[model samples]
Target: MQISQQDVHQALERGEFVPHFQPIIRLRTGQLYGFEMLARWAHPELGLIFPGDFIEQAERDGWISELTYQLLRKGLKEIAPLPGEPTLSVNISPPQLHGTSFVDQVHEAAAEANFPLNRLILEITESALAEDIVSVSKTVQSLKIAGCRLALDDFGTGYSSLLHLQSLPFDELKVDRSFVSSMTQKHDSRQIVAAVVGLGQSLSLTTVAEGVETEEQAEILLWLGCELGQGWLYGKPVPAEQLDEMMKRRQPHASNAILNGMTGRQSATALEIPPMQRFAQLRAIYDGAPVGLAFLDREMRYLSINRRLAAINGSPMEEHLGRTVAEMIPEFFPTVRPLIERALAGEVVAGVELTKPTQNPKELRTILLSYEPAFDESGEVIGVSVVLLDITPIKRAEEAQRESEAHFRHMIELIPQIPWIIDPEGRALDVSQRWLELTGVNDDQWRGFAWLDSLHPDDRQPTIDAMHRSFQSGEPIDIYYRVRRSKDHPWQLLRSRGSARRDDNGEIMCWYGSLEIIGESDAGKK
Candidate 1:
């Protein structure tokens, strides 16, 4: 049945469109990780209506944006008070995401609510990937910069899902309910789920299974190495109040079990064991930890060093034992002494990035050093625990990113013409120095769609429409527009032309354009 615009608008006015949150659980220990906010209409006569029943009509009637904004505000308000750092995932349609005001709206909502942007996850359907990917990628990058995570919802359901996964910066990949619901009974579904989990693992993304309604399905997902899950087995989408109750009822042990599993340990059991046995277990866990670990005495001599720490220092465990950091790394002793003294004074210092010279003087490694004071039963500082993490790759990546940005800025500044780069969403990511100077606008004013503010009011809409057309069609854009140089100066007619920059796979990455003064064209006279 078709829903009228009046009905939808009335529902909005009545505040009937609300968020129903479904629990997303950790598959390993069945702990509640977060909730995916699903939209539902609390209809007066027709009873509760799901998005499937009216979302298309809402979109057709131009009410989808309002609906999404309402849901976002409602979801954030509802989830803000929840305990245990639960994230709220809200679904975003392509049209809403592509709008110029979308990011601003999100930022405003988050700021108004004082919500932690990192705990908010915006989920986009895989089908949305079929839209102008360049715009989507840019929007994704902006969202990430704002500290909100993105998820590819219903992943593997669309034809270009893989491309979306590869091109976008999605932090999570949600396996489609179709695959999760049937994986237990269907061999093909099982294979698809396994493949998706494997792909997520390879990409270092969190994998979530949807529509897991049975223990068997959940078990299969766990066995397949899926990290998270959501379905009826966990709970149906419930109202905020009910969700609060459910959260209260959730067992703390479940979270503990999940954390232990994450640390490669089974559910911890209470046992009456000798102190020596307990010490051995702790030593084993510490030695096997992924990071380099070492224990030093009050005098800053190495009492024990794990193999990982030894390797990071370019030495063996035996050589590190009973030796001061100066003896092991004399070159770095000057830098290490202060941190050791601070740690010995019961101050825990961490995340100190420093250069560590290896045996090969030509090769210097960047490492992050952290020191924690160890205490005895009498509450006296006995020693310091040192952790060394090799960060050479991270440092190199940062340096490369800096160089790329510098080079891009240099090229743009050298160009005489007013040049700009826009993402598929028509948001300006880069504007040349000439363009900024011509408009007398600062960097902040020239970013995103703010460049439109410098355009003649009469020409802004047409230019935007033309850019949208070019983005959708992946064609070159050639448009003439009047831009304001200053308050005293008249609008200057300028012609701008740009084309899509595509990757090897023919996907649009960005649009580059340059503007030139048109010098009183016949059309400008009009």
Candidate 2:
């Protein structure tokens, strides 16, 4: 049963409604970066009810704005005692934001708490402002004018264009957690997140990704160039008291000091090597290594460069060292900036292909680059180590193969009938360009599974079984099948042949097969 507005009010009077704090972290740095305040209701009989259960109900009863105000006051009261006073992000309902006196209430709340308005982060969803943006824009602007932080929450999953985003005047962008969680596994999600992050960076806005739960997700986000992030992987929501306790337990043991040109946090007087010797050793390994290597400060400037990497930059090692990547390779700046920024924020980037400028005037070399955080032994990341491996030959070979395939495609396009190719596994390996052109199907989307879409249900299994045998036994096999082209068109008959190819080890590697159109009009009518 839903509680009444009066009942909710009574509960609030008795100090039942409160805020729960969830920690957000910078992926590269393990420090407590920020906190998102979640609303919670501690019921006497029901134990505890999360916002998911009661927040909308309160809104229906027209008491959510009042509840939110009370929670904000409670949140600030708890945050004030913290040592560093980390940024506090709170979710704001669109109704509340658009309500009259909303700006006044927020200002009065901050003034009463004597809190820094800049540290208060207000988050709002795109859906909430979908109805009327004019009023919403004014409301948000007024908040920002009052010296409060503004964030466009739940970015993506909306039709709102860049025009809406620009009009919001948001200072931070909280990428929808769905995109952040799925980015590592899906290309579409990765592209979407990358685009959003790019938009944020171009506007000089801080981008925070939510729902980061694993190291892989964190690594991908870092590689994609996101800055601040929050998720269960960092820390789940907790009470203010619990947050304080957790901080105390995890705080560093020492304040960290610098001694003899090295950041010193370890004990003095044992197995000490000269700083110059250490630097020299690092530089020596870097110079002689077959793989390219370089050092970068937090801002992604080349702190040191080795001969191999310098060759990739088309300059002397000394000349390229100490330069920003944007300066050395301006063309790659847009694509690589996020990575450098993520590394600067304390995240490792591995297995990313970076196109580098080479000494050959017109050539570009693709290299696999990995960047790891570098510390001065004080556990604070001061710079990064970059390793680059040339993969130009591999890339060139792949391109040549693609070009040859394109030529074969052109040849197939000239044929009168649809043609197709399949591997031994009965999966579509390739299809004639004419078949795709006539069917209005994308050639790139013609993956193994898609070929099934073209076959008659009755003939599909038989065709597949025969192809499997041909591949497994290294024999030439032929079969007849009826293929469905379109719902309005009759099933067309076809003759398919399969031939197997084996590697030097005599293990079957692939099946080369073709489907040739055959009908009553054709002589090969079998």
Worst 10 residues of 2 by lDDT: 252-261
The TM-score that candidate 1 achieves is: 0.49
- Residue pairs that clash (backbone atoms under 3 angstroms), model 2: 28-346
Worst 10 residues of 1 by lDDT: 264-273
State residue 232's C-alpha deviation in candidate 2, in Å: 1.1
The C-alpha lDDT values of all candidates are 0.82, 0.75
For every model shown, what is its TM-score relative to the native structure?
Answer: 0.49, 0.50
Expressed as tens digits, the lDDT of each residue in 262-374 for candidate 2 is: 33322222213343565678778877999888888877788788898888767787777678888887887798778767776779888998776667869877889787887
Please write out the lDDT profile of model 1 over residues 1-526, one tens digit for every residue.
Answer: 6887788879999999989999998776667789999889999999988889988877677788888888888888878877788999988887876746788888888877778999999999977778788887888889999999999988887878878888888899999999987776676788799899888877878888889888777666765678888888888899877986888786622322345335423522222233356678988998899889999998889998889989988888999899888999897889889999999999999999998666789977899999999964224687998998999888889999999999988886776677778898888998777777677798799788898998877889999999889888888999988875676666678899998999999999899988888764333332
- Candidate maximizing lDDT: 1
Q: What local lDDT does model 2 show for residue 295?
A: 83
